[model samples]
Target: MGKATGFLEFDRLSEQNIPPHERVKNYKEFVLHLTDEEAKVQGARCMDCGIPFCNNGCPVNNIIPDWNDLVYRQNWEEAIKVLHSTNNFPEFTGRICPAPCEAACTLNINSDAVGIKSIEHAIIDKAWELGLVKPQVADKKTGKKIAIVGSGPAGLAAAQQLARAGHDVDLMEKNDRIGGLLRYGIPDFKMEKSHIDRRMEQMAAEGVNFLTNHNVGENIHPDDLIKDYDAVILSGGAEWPRDLPVPGRELDGVHFAMDFLPSQNKVVAGDKLSEQILATDKHVVVIGGGDTGSDCVGTSNRHGAKSVTQFELMPQPPEKENKSMVWPYWPLKLRTSSSHEEGCDRDWSVATKELIGDNGVVKELVASRVEWKDGKMAEIPNSEFRIKADLVLLAMGFVSPQQSILEKFGVDKDARGNVKADTEGKKAYFTSRDKVFAAGDMRRGQSLVVWAIREGRQCAHAVDEYLMGSTSLPR
Candidate 1:
């Protein structure tokens, strides 16, 4: 431990943000990182408990205590090393991850947990500033080839690991650019695309080839991958956004959150659009309260929306969790994201009845209060109301992986329509076809970026073992 009573002496501190008015003026990151002294104090808050539940809570199993101590001692180079030992992209996670590790901290029982995420942010930012992060190309060649479908977090992680193991790795993306969601789904204001570009450069230096605009299933055949590579790993994300098939669904202003968010990201990327889907000077209603919904709120604010409202089908969760009961586990509690703080009218226990429009453009949304009975949601008859909404973005979440790619591979699918792979037992990550494996959202359905990284790392080990009968890579 850095100090005997460090946990007792220091309190948790989060990163500061720019004023909402200032941030909404442009598309750029707004979080102001802690200074070195502040970061050290935050790091000192780690108890360094004998059994660190934070490790278990982290999907990537980062050595949280070790890095905390390292940063507390101002040993930033070592801190970065420890951080990178498990997570390949601390910058990405530091910016976007919800930090379940903090919830699972031993200190969280009484005192606040150490500022693990902020410490991580400081370490990575310092590493970048000092030019400490670099590519590590293999010294010896294994001469084995691997093809990874999808260039999202999962595919990138797997590709990097396999490339470092001396295997020839090709990371393929169906999109016009490399990053699947990271490049498009996420707004630049949350995490700029430069982060992805820098990592891509490092991966290229490490001998991992990236092929953009390659729709492996539609344009390139599954047979092509099998013939060219020893193994194929499917890491394509779960797309297929859940939809509302109510009355007036085909209205001009009603759109999917994915369709709405990506276009703004494209515009931020300097793409000029003749007729963009915008919320400017309009009343925007975002359906479904989640990260995507929060993102929509933020984007609409940026577009200068007249007003913004978000709806949650389920009732609102308690502001504070029952820590006694949910200790060391992620609890159900209200989470107000940065987007929510920007400005939003949030409603819970709401169900949309239909989109009300005139001349094929959305004018308002018809909705009603919902009550749960026997685990089923039913709209209350007399609680119906109409809210002005010039644009309606559906942020309900994804249903499954895109069926076209799954169909092309002819892989078995589970009842949820996710790619069928034994993620447990002896045949974990193995698809129905020989020499084919699936991971990330393709197998697990819609999930956090941390979960995707975990699956990617594990899938790499599975693939390595399948090829060489053993693997040094950590699962």
Candidate 2:
């Protein structure tokens, strides 16, 4: 350990964010990474605990303590090396991921956890600035080609790993751009698109062929990929959003979170949409209290909405979790995102009953208070209320992967509607269809970007082993 007693000496310090008023004016990143000294101090807060639960807490199982010690010692190059050893894109995870690692920190039991995410942000940004991040071109070619569908975190990670393992990887995306959700689903205010573009450049230099606007199930038949490529990997994320099938669901103003979010992102990326959904001068109601809903709030604020309100069906969680009961694990606590800090009327335990509309456009939302009793939701009597809502965005998470792609490939589905695949044994990641594999949300359903990256890396190892009869890539 770089500093044995440093945890006791230093308090946790986090990165600063731009004021909501100032940041909401433009669709640009506002969260500033910690400075070198601040990051070093934060890193020093990492305890010399024998068992590092932070590693287990992190979806990618990053070597947290190693990098923490390196950052504390001001070893910038080594810090990034340790970071990249597990996470393919620290820039992505550092910016958007809710740090489960911090929750599992030994210091968190009694005190503020180390600012691990901020330190990671600093390390990766410094690495890029110092030219430490570069193409890892393979010395030898395996002559094996893999077609990876979907260019999200999962696809990107898998492509990067397989390419480094000397395989020709064709990373395909149905969208007009490279990054699937990262390019569209995520607002630029949280994580700018330049980070994804930078990695795309690095990946191209590393011999990954990027094919954009390539819809395999539609334009390109699924059989072609299996026939032409040595292996086919389905890294496509879960795109089927959960819908609220209440009255007036057919209203023109009601839209899925994906339908509403992508257009704003496209506009931010300098694309012109003839009929893009905007919250300008309208009363916006965003249903669901997850990250997607928060994103809607941010984007609505940016769109100059007359008012923005967020609704969560579940009861509100405690502002602070009981650390004694949930220590070393992700605790249920109220999380206020930067978007929520901007401006939003947030309510919990409210369920929408109907979307009242004038003509074909939504005008108001009728909802009622709810209470949980015996694990069942029970509506309170005579608690119904109506609120003005010119637009409604449903962000109640995703239910399953798009069945079209799965059907096209003829892969077996689990009970949850995701591609049926195991993470262990010889058939790890292998789908029902021969030479076809599934990973990320396609296999495991809706999850974090870090989890997607982890699944992608492991799936790459599985595919590499299947092809070469052995694999050096870490799972």
Question: Each candidate's root-mean-square deviation in Å?
Answer: 1.1, 0.7
The 10-residue segment of model 1 with minimum total lDDT is 3-12
lDDT tens per residue, model 2, 195-290: 999999999999999999999999999999999999999999899999999999999899999999999989988998899999999999999999
Error of 2 at 190 (Å): 0.5
Model 2 lowest lDDT segment of ten? 11-20
Q: Evaluate all candidate structures by whole-model CA lDDT and list the values in order.
A: 0.92, 0.95
lDDT of 2 at 431: 94
lDDT per residue as tens, model 1, 1-475:
7875888887778899999999999999999888999999988888858999999999999999999999889999999999998998998899999899999999998778778888899999999999999998998888899999999999989999889888999999988788888888889889999999999999999999999888988889998898889999999999999999999999999999999999998888898888789999999999999999999999999999999999999999999988899989998999999899999999999999989889999898999999999989988879999999999999999999999888888899999999999777668899998889999999999998888888898899899888988889888
The positional error of residue 124 in candidate 2, measured at the CA in angstroms, is 0.2
Q: After superposing candidate 2, which stretches have Cα over 4 Å from the reference?
A: none
- Model 2 Cα displacement at 173 (Å)? 0.5
User: At residue 225, what lDDT does model 1 achieve?
Assistant: 95
Q: How accurate is candidate 2 locally (lDDT)?
A: 0.95
* Positional deviation of residue 78's Cα in model 1 after best superposition, in angstroms: 1.2
Off by over 4 Å in 1: none
